[model samples]
Target: MTAIRDDGSERDRVLANGAVMAAGTVVSRMSGFVRSTLLAAALGAQLHADVFNIANTIPNMLYILLAGGIFNAVLVPQLVRAMRNDPDGGDAYTSRVITLAALFLAVVSVLLVLAAPWVMELLLDSRFSEPALAAQRDSAIDFARYCLPQVFFYGMFVLVGQVLNARGRFGPMMWAPIANNVISVAVLALYLVVFGPAQDVFGAFSADEELLLGLGSTLGIAAQFVILVPYLRSAGFRYRPRFDFRGTGLGHTLRLGVWTVLFVIVNQVAYTVVVRLASSGTASSADGTGYSIYSSTFLIVMVPHSVVTVSLATAILPRLSARAAEDDLPGLSRSLTDTLRSALAVVLPFALLLPVIATDLANVVWGHGAAAAHYELYAPSLALFGAGLAFFTVHYLMLRGFYALERTRTVFWIQCAVGGTNIVAALVLVRATDAEHTSPALVLAYSASYLVGAVISYAVLHRLVGGLRTARLVRFLVRAAIAAGLSTAAAAGTAYLLHRAAGDPHWVVAAVWVVVTTCVDVAVFVALARVLRLGEVTTVVDTILRRVRPRHVPS
Candidate 1:
């Protein structure tokens, strides 16, 4: 009975925290949609968008490649340990981390700025070197130079945000990205107002245009980092420059970080290959979509993961680490497995429904100005990404388990397989298709890669944890798939009938169809979940119900 009560309490705490982060993520994503839409409206979805998108994106890719893996996965557990074991409650360690990270980011950001031309040369394709496309490629390199400074801000934002997370402050980190989105929206809006939409989809941006878009992007990132400062202070993190890196346990953290750094190296290398391939997709064809379409659709597919799995895992990681610290493998396994089931209970439905709504969803997102004519190009990649996202959610959670166990080396090796699969598949798949099929092919590569990742990571973590309650997990997966399958069929049937009834409806009507279909899908899924008695489903549903249910007052 006590154990049941404890589980309930744990779930409630996790759900409450998850809810806050999810709400912030939802808002941030909605604003991000506006931002992406504006981007499409301004630049169209082909070479023009790809040039700016890829250039502005390099800083983030570099940041992640350099430090994000260690900061995100490795440091959280280490910070948790410091807080628990250190007499000063990890303040010195946290400060040292901040100081060292800031120094690293500053130096790396400077070098990256110097190497911007070379970086663009590596990431863009051979087609861009042609005389006709040389101007566009130069424009991309210019944009990268302006945008590389964002590496420092992005690293700091995430590093500080992780500090907050380690201190049991999660909402601020999730919420602070909204500031970045809002700034981006403003920047794009200003671009539209000043320069208007790009006249030629395949044209290069002028110098002035690059200045606004590139510098504006860096400004947004800086603002995002600034927004976290107050929150850091409020979270009781007083930042002092602790230069005494010796005898301060920094070496231990760095030792653990080596494999994680290698992990990100593999990840970023694969991504660089993808970018190179994607860049060629647009340059090789006048009207074909590439990096921009691939990235935007990928984000849409990741909405469930960003909202549900990430938030849930962030809130649960501290507890899992605590269990591991106590050497309670069974307890840690139980919590990890339970969290996995709960997350999949929410994510599976999204995977099934995405394809049904892909066309309409694309219309709603990219159907504006210069983008409207090509918005449909996003649908195939979008549809394929749903499978990828579901696979990635599983892989992501399994990595958290490994992190908790300080199994960074194992995670690195697993990521190598995933990354290798992505690079090989992308190289092979893209070779077989034209420009139009590029994004879809890449999506297939992504899905296939993570399927490999999910299987390997889960099996390894299961063994490491003595058992990840595999029988229970398999049963839940089977039942959830059944429920989600029926729900998807119902949703698809409704969509088909609605299409017949409305026959080439406008965006408003299409949106109405999506709403009605989603309603029916959820209703059927809930009914079936109840019938199947899936506790994970019941726990989430009942918790939501309890939140919205009316409460009687003292009167």
Candidate 2:
């Protein structure tokens, strides 16, 4: 198993990594669809939104802090160095680090559980004024308690998973999330079916609905943990219960990890603040239904965001680390630029299409409910928020570079600056908006924050790389915008035609629109790329399809 290099022709690496990551992500995202659908059906939008928003925030933050934020940034580079410097002790170092991370995260999980009440109070903001609403907040906190523990399991899983990835055993790490989603969907279904009509188990109707959902979902978390053990074992790794601090490489990781945690805390706190602003409800109602609406909408938009972020981050970070170690600055620069272009190309259609079909997608996936209004509010956000995916992907890759050079503090402060801007923007937007509406204002604020941050990130990268081929990048963006416009029109037309012909069955309409939009988007982009002599676009698409195509398959 030869290690994949992130040198020269970085566009090729980006395309190859994007394809694999996208395929796996598609499966995991499908599972998310199933999970969200089930929860919506079982508990309606308000309850489902409440649970999803809070419960996810816990692990979401943990994931950023550990696996995504710190672990990849810190763990991979350290492990790679260990493997290079002391080949014989590679396994021992891996084992000790895995043990320490697990123990540390386990303690963190306990602390989070203990502090759930306070965390919930902060996130829910004005949403929980009434006694019933307060109870719902407690229910959310309990659910958070259940979901938070999985961070420990997943954190350890990623530590070992990265080792496998470092060894060129990429398949298992890529597919693990699919298995986790499967377990989640299965458990949610089982709980709903078995406990749905039982008043004692589903406390939504009984005095204990909150506890049941909390405990039941925790069982789902345990299932997710169980699924990863075999994958870990197969990767020639095992988690032993030990915490060693002597020459275990914790120092290198800790410096980065602490900053990474702050970065994540700032990032998530901004998100939570947005949710809080929206949840604070309109000044007129005081019921906080606005928060519910925003929460529901955010979940739908996040599907594409998650898919894009995970796809690129998982594949690019390790390779970026290796590139930095060799001081291959040009290779690193090319890789980052190519990845940005390709990621933008890939995500643009979704960014356009989602807003066009937001109504149908929301109704189909979540059903007609109080969430319908929320969906509409969240629709434009899909495009605005989705466009940021490429920028965020670049930011993720750049942070990895920072870590590869062991510049943890730089990564930390950069994140804080970006995240702080978002928080302040959200607060100011909500404060300045008319008392009657705040959700859209907050969403706009978020989008604006990303825009500003992305510009800063690009400027920093420019200084670091001694400048990129701005002319080429500008041309690509122009071409991509044209492609997106054509695709958006195609999606809108297809959606309208399908609705008129089929009388708008949500599921069928969504399916047809997805197909039509995807085909048109790809076709138009390819044509524009060729017409404009954008070789990178053609080169990337050709390389990706070539690599993935079966021997028996035609070119």
Candidate 3:
């Protein structure tokens, strides 16, 4: 009974933490959407948009390539161990880690800036031909030069934010991005007011225009990093730069990080193919599909996963690390299973319903200013991405499981397989389809890669953990799929009727239909879950009720 009570308490704590993180994610994603909408309005989804999108994307790619993957996968377990066993509460170790990361990233950022032109040449599709796209190529390199410095700030932000997470402070990491988005939105808004939106070609961007987009975007990342400093202080962590890394077991951390670094390299190699294909499509035509629209659609599809799955995983990771440290395999397995179920309980329905409302949602979100012209292109990509949402979420959670076990090599190999599949699939699809249709095909490739990865990861993780309640998980997933299918049908039917009544796909009408259809979908899903006695759904409902209902205490 005591053990059971303890388990229940832990579950409650996890859910509460997850709720806080999810709330923060919701706000961050909303602000991020606003930022993207402003960007789409200002730039549109064309050659100009692709130049900025690809250039802006490089800093993040560099961060991941250099240190982001290592920092994320290895820090939690290392920090957890230090917090438990170190005499100075891991303060010195944390300081050393931060100093090392900062120094390395600063050098990397400077070099990347110097090499921006070459980097752009390598990353942009070869089809950008020297003669025809000279101006576009030059503009992309210019943007890359200004944006390359973000690598330092981006790396610092993740390192510091993960430190906070290790200390069981999750809200700051999730909320800090809101500041980034707000600043970006303001910058884009100013651009619209000052220079107006860029059209058709990259030749319109002057030196000042390039500076506004480039430096403004970098400023947001700097702000995001700066905001986390106070949170570290509040968490009782102070940055006293300790260079004495000789004795602190950072070597062990780096050993673990080696595989993580390889994992990211594989993932990025596959993404490089995607970037080339996506950017190449834009170069093929003045007005066509490219990275900007694909990225925008991806952002929308990732909202639920970011808000729910990421929150649950982040909240539960410390606990999983602790259990792994203790070598309590059974406890670790059970906790992971519970967290996965909780995440899927929310994610599955969202994934299924996303396709049903993709068109309406896309129109309402991106159908403004110059962006409305490309709504038809963006919506189908979003729907295709929706189909793979569940697989992506599952794959993400499974990788975290591997991280908890400190099995970075396993993850690296799995990523290799997934990345190889994605690149090959994307290449084949691009060849088979026209430039206009490549976005959805590429999106499908993204999903298929993850579906392969998730299945493999699940099977391997189940064995590593001794058992993952495979039979039970399979049963729950099957039932959830059925429930989600029914919910999607209901949402589609209701949305179709509303569309027919409205007679036009105005933003207002799309907005209303989306809300109504979503409400209907949730109602049907919950009703079916109740009829089926799905324990996961009941657990979530009970948790919500317990949080909302007032409790009476004796005076």
Candidate 4:
């Protein structure tokens, strides 16, 4: 009975933490949507936008290539172990880790800024070197110079957030991004007020305009990192410089991170290929199809994953690590399965219905200011990305499983397979298709890559754990697929009828369809879940009610 009570308490704690993280994620994503919308309005989905997007993306790519993969994948488990066993509650170790990471990232950021031009030339499409795109290439270099410093801030934010997570604080990491998005939205709004939207191409932007955008973006990242410091203090963590690094188990941590570094290198190689392909579309005659559109659509598809899957994973990872540390494979397996089911219960419906209403959703989100004309460009890729959402979520969760087990090499090899597939498929698709039409195909390749990743991850995880409740997971997924299909069909048919009756796809029509279709789809899904008696659905509903309902007052 005591064990059962403890298990129930643990379950409740996980749900509560997940709810907090989910709420934070929802706020962050909503703010991010605002930020993206403002950016789209300010820049439009053209070459100028592509240049800015690509330049801004380079910092993150560089970070992953250098340190992000290690910090993200290896540090949490190590920190958790330290917290549990170390005499000082891992304080000195944490400080040393943070100090070293900051110094490393600072050096990397400076070097990257100096190397911005060469880096741009290497990562960007060859079309940028052509006489027509020379100006765009130059602007990209300038933007990179300003944005590259964000690598340091990005590393800081993730390291501090991981420290918070190790101490069982999850909400701050998820919530901190809201401040970043808010700052970015304000900057973009100011840009719109001042510059009045970018002219058609990249060459039209002046130097001051480039500085405004580049510096504003970097400032937002700085703000994101700054806000987390106080939270770390509030969590009883104080920053103290610890320079003594040798013989402190830091070597072991670094050794564990080696494979993660390789993993991210492979992943970045694939992303570089995609970036080249996507950016090539900017040179095409298509008005709104390019890297910017692909990136924006990808952002939309990730909303559910970020809000649901990431929240659950963050909440459960420390616990998973604890179980793995204890050699409690059964507990770890149960925890992972429950977390996966919970994530899919929410994500599967969105994945299914998003494609059906992608156009309306895109218009509703992006149809404002100068962006209205290009809103339709986002739908095709959004739809394609939606198809692979579940697979991507599964793959992410499986990677976390490996991280908990400290199996970085296995994770590295799996990413190699995933990245190899993505690179090959992207090359073929880009070479075969017109640049203007490559967005959907690129998205398809993304989904396929994850499909391969999910399969490989599941097989390995199943074997590692002696069994991952594969039969149960398979049955649950089948039921979910069935329910999602019926929900999507119902929603799509309703949307079509509504569109026909409205006689147009105006923003107003799109808005109404978004509302009507989402309602009908969710209703159908819930009804099917009831009829099917899906346990995950019940768990989700009960958890939500538990969160929202008023508790009885104690006498």
Best by TM-score: 1
TM for every model, in the order presented, reads: 0.97, 0.85, 0.96, 0.96
**Residue lDDT tens for model 1, 1-555:** 012223557777887788889889999999999999999999999999999999988999999999999889999889988988899999999999999999999999999899888899999999888899988999999999999999899989999998899899999989999999999999999999999988999999899999999989999999989999898788887999988999999998999999999999999999999999998889889767699999999888878898889999999898888887888888888888888898999899889999999998888888887798898999999998988888998999999999998999999999999999999999999999898899999999999999999999999988888888899989999999999999999999999998887665677777788899889999999999999998888888777777668998996
Quantify all predictions' global Cα lDDT against the true fold: 0.90, 0.63, 0.87, 0.87
Query: All predictions: root-mean-square deviation over Cα?
Result: 2.1, 4.1, 2.2, 2.1
Whole-model lDDT, model 3: 0.87
Error of 1 at 494 (Å): 0.9
Candidate 4, residue 39: the lDDT equals: 86
Worst 10 residues of 3 by lDDT: 1-10
Task: Encode model 2's per-residue lDDT on 356-411: one tens digit a residue.
Answer: 66656666666533333333443444444555554555566566556766777666
Off by over 4 Å in 4: 1-9, 202-204, 550-555
lDDT of 1 at 488: 97
lDDT of 3 by residue, 210-299 (tens): 999999999999999999999989999999987888968999999999999999999999998899899878888755688988889989
Clash count (model 3, backbone only): 0
Q: Which ten residues in a row have the lowest lDDT in candidate 4?
A: 1-10
